[model samples]
Target chain A: MSGGYPKGRIRREDLISAAAVVYGEAGYHGGSLREIAKRAGISHAGLLYHFPTKEALLAAVLERRDAEDADREQLGVPPGLEVLRRFLTLAEHNARHPGIVDLYSRLAAEAVTPGHPAHEYFERHYRDARHRVRDSLRVLADTGELRPGVDPDEAALAFIALMDGLQVQWLTTPSEVDLAGALRGFLQTLLTVPLQP
Target chain B: MSGGYPKGRIRREDLISAAAVVYGEAGYHGGSLREIAKRAGISHAGLLYHFPTKEALLAAVLERRDAEDADREQLGVPPGLEVLRRFLTLAEHNARHPGIVDLYSRLAAEAVTPGHPAHEYFERHYRDARHRVRDSLRVLADTGELRPGVDPDEAALAFIALMDGLQVQWLTTPSEVDLAGALRGFLQTLLTVPLQP
Candidate 1:
């Protein structure tokens, strides 16, 4: 089907990008691979030649989105309290791209089902994020940023919960939620209050 | 289909109950109204006669779920700080019913899309929940339950966020997440501290 190998790779990338948009808009079950093919300006068969199946396409799309985000953010080595500010920046970035954020929020909820295609992705995502955030909070506590008696691990859990919970509300009523502002307010509280145990 | 009979009303109730089960298990997009009809022991045509379309059936199911919940809990007159205790009881009850919780989380996420069938339901749900929780928190603050510097509105927002955030993680990894325990911990913090601004 491909006269040139490089072009075929490019086509595959195009399909994944298009599929991301479709998945973001329609969600996993509601999204159609054929519709993705149309958006990518390729025959459905040609799209299948690269992805082979909807599950394969989904995996590829998720993988690519993560890779692209890591590259764009260059989110390397933690910077302690400064790292919290980075989350606000990321939230601002996400607000600009509601489609991707909506897709993620929707999939995260759907993946609660152990058998859902994206189940493993979400489980790993939450576990890693939780540990990383906890470690960062510990760094703050060690540096005397957190108030006395505030357990870093507990703070981490509550902080992450606030972020995720705000996302759910934000997605439902975008106009009513100031995603980054809410996080900023919470961070200020963490700094100012003892957040007693 | 009705023939001026009470049986039609009973059938509608049966269909809504069945649909709730189906939706809870498979989510809105994954759920099939026909399957709901089958479970209700009614023909597909009869189901349609009762609920003209899948969206109509979804609305009915949601309405019934709300009504039954209100009846069971009699959550009409907000009982101030006791309302916080009610949330813990509700979380414990939810822990025993993963299907409904999963369904709710899934639908809440799905309805993030402005055009989704359940979008209005979620938007209204959040607005109402936030207001009610805020109002109850104010009652507590007025009764000297809250410490100095505590803002009822801010406390309400954060409280709701924690409950929702905990629900998402709990649904994914039930054994690791003690939903009620987490909420209880947060509630204790709210009572013991000012949650400094």
Candidate 2:
């Protein structure tokens, strides 16, 4: 369908986008593979040819989201306060993309159940997110940008929590909650240096 | 059956408990009244008699939780740093009751979809929660217990987000996340005095 793009690859991408919307609205538990296939304009058997199970499709969906976010934010580049700033920029990006935010928030909550298909995915995702945030905090601590007496690990956990928790509130009441502003306030309290770069 | 409790009232309570269990595990969209009825040892029609719709049952479940928390914490009493202390205590209680926490986190995330039955309920719930937290912060500010330059409203939002976000992380990896400790650390940064009362 496209220059140098295979038809199968395009179909797989279509399925992932459709799955994201279905899962975003009804959640994984409420969403069904049949519905996802319907949205993707494919036969159920054809969808199965690509993803043998709903769980497999979910894994792909999650991976695609992370890869896209990483590419957009330059996730690991220029680590330190810069990484934290990238997160603020990401939060701003999230404000404009409520669908992705909804999908993430819904799935993360649903995945807390021990045996949910995506439980392990979210567990690892958060662990990685925490590590990234903590790594940035450690860099700031070494550079004297972090305030005195702040624990890097604890601050890392808190910062991740703030970003996640703020999304839920912002989604519910968009007019009242300012996602990046709250994050900036929390960062300002934790850092001795200016965040404006 | 022996006490003065009426059969109808007891049946209603039983249905509510069963509905909570079903809705907690499967969320409102994925949960069914028939299953809830079966769990309560009643017919579907009987369950419907008590909770006209699934949405009605969800409302009852949410209200019961808030009523229980309010009763336990004396929500409006003291009205200052003491209110904040009650929240810390509530967080401790939530750690011991992961089921309630799971139910809440799941429902809150699900309710973010506009037109979700619990949408308005959560909107009002968060509004009330923010006002309560902000009211306490205002009290602390009046007495100079709050750190200088901290905005009460912003701090209140961050605190709520922290607690909500921490619960998700704690639920996912209970061994890694310390719910109350992170919260206390955040409060320590905002307040001049110890929260050990």
Best by DockQ: 2
lDDT scores of the candidates, listed in order = 0.77, 0.91
TM-score of chain B of 1: 0.87
Over 4 Å off in model 1, which ranges?
Answer: A1-5, A192-197, B1-10, B193-197
Q: Show what share of the native A-B interface contacts model 1 retains.
A: 0.66
- Residues B1-197, model 2: lDDT tens digits: 56355987888899989988887899889999999999999999988878888888888898899899999988877658888888999999999999999999999999997899999999998888888889888998899899899898999999999999999999999999999999989987888888776
Docking class of 2: high
Clashing pairs in 1: none
Best of the candidates, TM-score = 2
**Residue A178 lDDT in model 1?**
76
Worst 10 residues of 1 chain B by lDDT: B188-197
Off by over 4 Å in 2: A1-5, B1-5
- Model 1 Cα lDDT, one tens digit per residue, B1-197: 54566988888889988888887666688788789989999999989999988899888878876886667666676657666666677778888888778778878877888788989998998888778777877887777777556666666777777788878888876766778877776666656443222
**Shift in Å, residue B139, candidate 2:** 1.3
lDDT of 2 by residue, A1-197 (tens): 45244888988999999999999999999999999999999999989988999999999999999999999988877659888889998999999999999999999999998899899998998898889888888899999999999998999899999999999999999999999999988988889999886
What local lDDT does model 1 show for residue A157?
70
Report how far off residue B32 is in candidate 1 (Å): 2.9
